[model samples]
Target: MSVRQAQGPAGRGTRPGLWREGLAALRSGDLRLIWLAQVVSQLGDGVFTLGIVVLTVELTASGLALSGTLMAQLLPYALLGAPAGALADRWNRRLTMVASDIARGLVVALLPLLHLTGWLHAWMIPVVAFLLTTGGLFFDPAKNALVPTVTPAGALVRVNALLAGTRQVLFIAAPALGGVLAAAFGTMTLFWIDAASFFLSAAILARMRVSGRVPALTPGPPSPRPSATPLPQGGRGAGGEGSPVRGHLLRDVQEGLRYVWRVPVLRLMVIVGTFINFILSPLPVILPLLFLTVLGLGTAAFGTALSFIFAGFLLGVAFVGVSGSRIHLGYLTTAAMAVAGLAVLALGAGPPLTVIHLIGLAGGAAVGIMEVAETTVLQRESTDAVRGRVFALYESVSQGGRAVSVALAGALSDRVGLRAMVYAVGALTLACAVLLALSPPVRRLARG
Candidate 1:
């Protein structure tokens, strides 16, 4: 029997209809493994981020130097993301993910070695950051592409909610623990912990079994494969030549870009996401200065502010989970982005800590809502064959926009003051949200 046939009714014996389908997908072993791996990786990533920043500051005490390190970490995604996406489409996603984990683990493990030898310098930090993120360039596309393949069609929203919720948890817990670890064992020890976490993640991933084997591209018809049950209506892997594909890497990159541009709703999403990133990019760079210099707070206080934002994020995630199928997602997305922008503006208005935390909470909630909605939209809209490449381009553009925004923020904040910069970014974000809401294509896609 065909794989689809053997599996019986597509979503049979599932809970009630759409909601049940989504829940079952979330509960699937494949998606569960992916979620588990991501949770582990994100937590480790938080620790690594804290450790790196603390270590860099200890070594160089220069804000410019730290900014440069962050820039280095982000630049690779901007530079290499398209090619990474194409490669992901052509490769076995499981292998791609595992290799990424292993690569990150090895790179992080070398940090202590460099530190012990006194070879770690402020300049070297950027290079290491680049290498680390380069691995992510490969990992992210593969992972995003894999999600739709494993889940039931109706379950995309719920799975996305679960993913968003886990990320919220990581945001809340990881940095706090990272701070404590950095204070106690030092930053180098945190790197060791990060490395171990990567290995653990890879081990977990090794056990997952993705349904469709990504076929090696050649000059002929795609290899025939064993069938699972026929997927549901609007099921994935339905179109295309299904042929062994071959093309120039650059051409593949161009093809991916063209594919994204051709889709009107996806294009709108890219634009909106770009604007949001532009608005938020300054927070990480300028917020520390604000807290330390303007608010007269210590590192611990700054961490507290971050925690407030994360707390809001957790609440938003929960909200998304509970209302995944019931809400008008597009409207929610528009509202969330607007609220996030406004909250950022409020954050800069010099309110008391209680007020600041409230603003942070609001902004975090907005971010959580926006992310889950956005991811679900993308998963539903894209074809599996092209999904990785498209997401790669998405990530690359988002990171590139963020880099530009960071640069702009730094320059603008330096000249006009941080408060003005915050207010300006907030205005731009709100404008983008309005634009997205007005776009007919975006509204239609959200309803779908």
Candidate 2:
């Protein structure tokens, strides 16, 4: 358990240094495998999303079709996230991740063949996307909840930062690569590659050490050695006094909600978070509109701007990983939202495209800072009993927020100018930050 500690502001080392902690986790053998599995899976996801977009364009050339496909990709979090998370607590996390990966690989592997044989239809894209997303509903929370199990105490920040940073980098690179590969060979190639990534992810995750929380086990005859037996507690086998309440799926879902509702910080965080999620959208529509219609800039401009955001985000993660203890995470989150607001304003102000890219870069960094800060807080604070459900609720609500944004964007994008839409986004983001600063409950969060 001994590892290198990070230096605090007063010059004393307080927590584990990022690289040292990461290496420690890697040496343990579980965290590195989990990290690798996620990285590979995300690469596949990037290509898969790109391939789908290309296939959609090839099939129908309709905006409505594209929107539907996008929704299919996101909505499963809203629909099944709670149930899936509840199940994660009931099942073995490693097995859940492995099964989900294997299932997804099998499903995604067939998509390219369907297209090659002329069996793929435009309607089926959303259907397949929905199924894949369903797998994600199970996979994501399980993966998240596993971090505390695998990572050492006080090093959750480094572990979470690594996970978040990796995803952001992949998100930036994956789509572009997928697009190129799709154009060079075909969308089928992208699909096959993505399928392979999932299979590899599954193979790696299957070997991880943590068994995670399991279902309620009935007490049997007492052991002769009283100290050896584990009492059932909080849907897990913990050493405790009385038998814990055996939670059904519905009850588990309720317990997650109750925990959030009772915690002032989590309650307020989720509320403001829903609004942030609504406006701070990396919506599929935003980039295309910026590149093609609003800015009238080519893909090169779009690519540059996109890269700025991703790189800035990764940099921000590195910053947090190194200096998380020095900053107030709640304040960091508020400031990040404010920066996003300014980025929106810059986008709408008709500034030079280079200036716009710079602003986007800064905004991306702010978001990266916000993401790791908030997640570290949550991951550090939450107990294993409710961690999976907490993540599930957050995902569900965030996706719901995105749905609201999507609906607004669709309904208003044609009625109003894109500039007007950008302005509204900016204004709402600022308003959310203002509300966050004003809230007494959120302020108290930092003290605890």
**Candidate 1, pairs of clashing residues:** 3-227, 3-228, 3-229, 4-228, 4-229, 4-230, 5-229, 22-155
**Local accuracy of candidate 2 as per-residue lDDT tens digits, 1-448:** 2122322333234444446655575676899898898899999999998888888988999989998998888888888888888887666778888999999998888788787798988999898899999998888888887776788755666677788999987887899899888778877899899899999999998887666544343354122211112233344433342233555789778867776776666777777877788886744456568567877888888878877877788888887777665556677778878887888777877678779778878878888888887786665455555667778888889887788787777567678767787788888988998888777765665553
Query: lDDT of model 1 at residue 394?
Result: 81
Q: Output the number of the lDDT-best candidate.
A: 1
Model 1 regions lying over 4 Å from their true place: 1-23, 116-122, 215-243, 288-305, 348-355
Per-structure clash totals for the candidates: 8, 1
- Model 2 has a clash total of 1
Off by over 4 Å in 2: 1-19, 116-118, 214-246, 282-299
Best by TM-score: 2
The positional error of residue 269 in candidate 1, measured at the CA in angstroms, is: 0.7
lDDT of 2 at 197: 97
